[model samples]
Target: MANIMAASMYMKIALVCMLVGTLLFVIGFSTVSWMVSSAYNRWEARGVWKVYSCGTSFCTYLSYGAWTYFGRNDYEHVRATQALECIGLIFALVSLLVLLLYLLVDSCRRRNSLIAFVVCVFAAVFFIVVGIAVFAIKLGYSYHVGWSMGFAIVGAIFMFVGGIMGILQLTCR
Candidate 1:
């Protein structure tokens, strides 16, 4: 009974971390500040095109000037990065579902939950890492990195920590 309780506690903590990470990832992925540059006036500027934006923000997923800068290549790269971020978000959602099952399903197999959680965590990390790599390769040299990148990195770290906690819970049981 104590073992079960301990595992439950760890799983709960892991779930919290994963959820926080997912939220951070979403914010980071959508923001246009992933890459920043400074003006002569010392003002920081972000890329004009981003994965998500509104008219109020004066940014879009693709802008007319993007084609002027790199033609179709920039557009394609941004689209691909957006797809990878979406995949990471999907993996996070799946992990949340598995965690919910782990908490609620008394009769569910423990091994299945362990496997599912681990796979989801790793998959999320993989997608996030790839997306960040692409962004870095495509834009890092041209512009300064910004808070969005930091947020994504921190989010990935949180997911990694949650994965480790999940593993510890399984082993302790």
Candidate 2:
């Protein structure tokens, strides 16, 4: 009984953080407010998958495979950012699922499984930071950063903290 109680504390903490990270990743990935442009710029808001035009009220969805651009460069950087974000989201989701399994299924609470979960969490954070870096590099501080980027950054920080707690659990064991 004591063992189960002790394990649950750390596992629950990790699960909650992973969940927040995954949710933030989704919100940031889909929202059209990653970079809000100034009055001088042509676009009003920009996301990984969509762009809102300052001139027009409508927003344009960026098709992944189409490789289209809106009166600008080829948007090669956008495509790369999209791919990296997708990969990071996948990793985050999978790691969260594994953590859930650890919480619900007794057999999955082994040390090896915990190690794998931590590895995936680290990978998710790495890919997400890389994607953000790639996106930021494209504009080079010309546009103002928006809430979407902030969400992603905070999400990564939460996940990292949770992973550290998981490590503490391991060390304590």
Candidate 3:
């Protein structure tokens, strides 16, 4: 039992993060989808681009696939899942980037809105930077399995918080 737990630490952490991210994505998507659909139904509302939220919803699920793969701890599985995770990361990151663009475009109408935009930008950048730093250290210390997993857990936690914020904004707004 101890050996099993020891072997699956990374998997356990990854699963926890994935579950949290998935829940946030669902709430965020539902809120945004409802808002946009209602606006369209009203006919008085003009078209608004919301591709970022849409993309995030899709990629967030893919992250689950990656987490499953990573949990398996098979080299081939990890590689495949890592690729998917990276793609999902790209989509997730792009979603945040697009939100920034939307904020920039509409910056004239709202003063305080920029604050949320800035926070989102900061969160996204922090996640990306932490992920890169963790991966870099992992590469350098290839022999240190436990240490690398620790860094990965930190990165995953950052992503989880960032994702939750991304979703919360959709509903709150």
Candidate 4:
């Protein structure tokens, strides 16, 4: 039974990692694409592009919020804190998914699209590390060795790469 439980825990950890990793990857792609699309639209049209640009900004900020919230420890109101964090995560994930569909269908030929794809893969890897950290936390593992700043740094690197891609799109494409 102990062995079975350990296996189950491992499986659970893997599933969480996969889901979260994929979601983060999607979010990274959406954010960079949103920036590129909004920039292009802003110059092409009148101020009408504000709507789309603002929406993109909102999504980017929310993605950051989701990551920060989930990455924190608010133990006073555990359920409420976690619920809010989950909501943020869900919103970020959904926005990314929508943005991905748009890119795949309407903008695959763009340079930013390829950059987005690469960032997504990187984000996925970081999320897997985060998942492992979460598993360690649950199993009463050491914080320093388990869920440490390493995962956070990895996540930051993904966003940084996405930002660089966004910047490059302005001049290169």
Candidate 5:
């Protein structure tokens, strides 16, 4: 009974952590500030999908001129980073389905469900970590790394901890 209680606690923790991680990752993944730089009194920002200017209080994604000075010309690994992070985001979102299944289906409440969810969480962390690492490495030192990168890293850490909690939940059974 004690072990079952402990496992239940772990499961809740894992679920909360994974949810937070997924939210953070999604925010960072969408925002246009993963990389930022200022030149000629103009601020430019880059995210997974768009490169825009944050020179004014409100950013303008339509500013093609903004990227001419940075981004693609300067970074070789941008596309790879996008691919890895996208894959990670997809895995994280898909893992939530396992939780839904466990809640809705009697058979999915078994240990295998926990294992599958944990594996998906871990896979998400793996791809996110690699993507962040690649971006951090390939991005020029002259530029200022933005909050989006930090968010992505923190998100990956949360997912990783969640995965550990999930493993503990499995052991209790």
Candidate 6:
């Protein structure tokens, strides 16, 4: 009985961490400021330039002068960046769904829940890492990482920690 209670506590903590991480991921993914081009000149000064994924195929760039540009134009790097971001978002959502299912189904099999949570957490971490890596590599040369990237990184860390906690919970059983 005590073991089950301990597992339950761990599970609850993991769920809360995942929930907050998911929210942060969503916010980061939606924002246009993953990277901002630094200001260089007066007219050539790209003031507060920001880029954001619009879909798997395209992204939007907002210039310093309030001008917005949209188009993939067959840019492979841009497409890849967008795709990765989308994948990360999907993984995070799926993880959240699995955690919620574990919570909702009173008759849920413990073994199944354990496997599902582990897989979901790992998958989420993988995608989030890859996505952020691609984004950083592609833009790091020309732009500075922004708050959105920071949020995504922090979210990834939370998700990873939550996964570890979930795994520990299983062992406690």
Task: Please report the candidate that would top TM-score against the real structure.
Answer: 2
Candidate 3 colliding pairs: none
Candidate 4 lDDT score relative to the true structure: 0.35
Query: Model 5, which residues run further than 4 Å from truth?
Result: 1-7, 54-59, 62-66, 69-76
Summarize candidate 1's per-residue lDDT along 8-94 as a digit string, tens digits: 677878988888888887777666678765433233334324433334335445442443342444455566677787898799788
lDDT (tens digit, per residue) of candidate 4 on 1-173: 12313322322332244345444533432332211222422311111011112332343223322332236743323233234334434443542453344234444435554455435434434443444334334423212231122333344344444434433433444
- lDDT of every model, 2 decimals: 0.71, 0.77, 0.36, 0.35, 0.78, 0.66
How does residue 131 of candidate 2 score in lDDT?
Answer: 93
- Relative to the unseen true structure, what is the C-alpha lDDT of residue 101 in candidate 4, on a scale of 0 to 100? 43
Ranking by lDDT: 5, 2, 1, 6, 3, 4
Which of candidates 3 and 6 is the stronger one according to lDDT? 6
| Model 5: per-residue Cα lDDT over 1-173, one tens digit each | 12323346777787788889988889888787888888657777777777777665666785333455535555457778889999999989877678556545666788888888988999999999999888777656756778987788888888898889888877887
Residues 18-93 of candidate 2: C-alpha lDDT, one tens digit per residue: 8887887788777877888756535667778776655555445454344334554577788898889888888888
Clash pairs, model 6 backbone? none
lDDT of each residue in 1-173, candidate 6, tens digit only: 12324347777788888988888877776666676653432111111124333444544554323443343332445556667767777777777777766666666646787778778788878877887776667544656777777778788888888888878877887
Q: What is the TM-score of candidate 1?
A: 0.78
- Model 2 — TM-score against the truth? 0.85
lDDT of 5 at 97: 75
> Which prediction has the highest lDDT against the true structure?
5
TM values, all candidates: 0.78, 0.85, 0.32, 0.29, 0.82, 0.75
Ranking by TM-score: 2, 5, 1, 6, 3, 4
Task: Report, for all candidates in order, the number of backbone clashes.
Answer: 0, 0, 0, 0, 0, 0
**lDDT of candidate 1 at residue 71, scale 0 to 100:** 40
Clashing pairs in 1: none
Over 4 Å off in model 2, which ranges? 1-8, 41-43, 56-71
In the predicted model 2, the residue pairs found to clash are none
What is the C-alpha local distance difference test score of candidate 5? 0.78
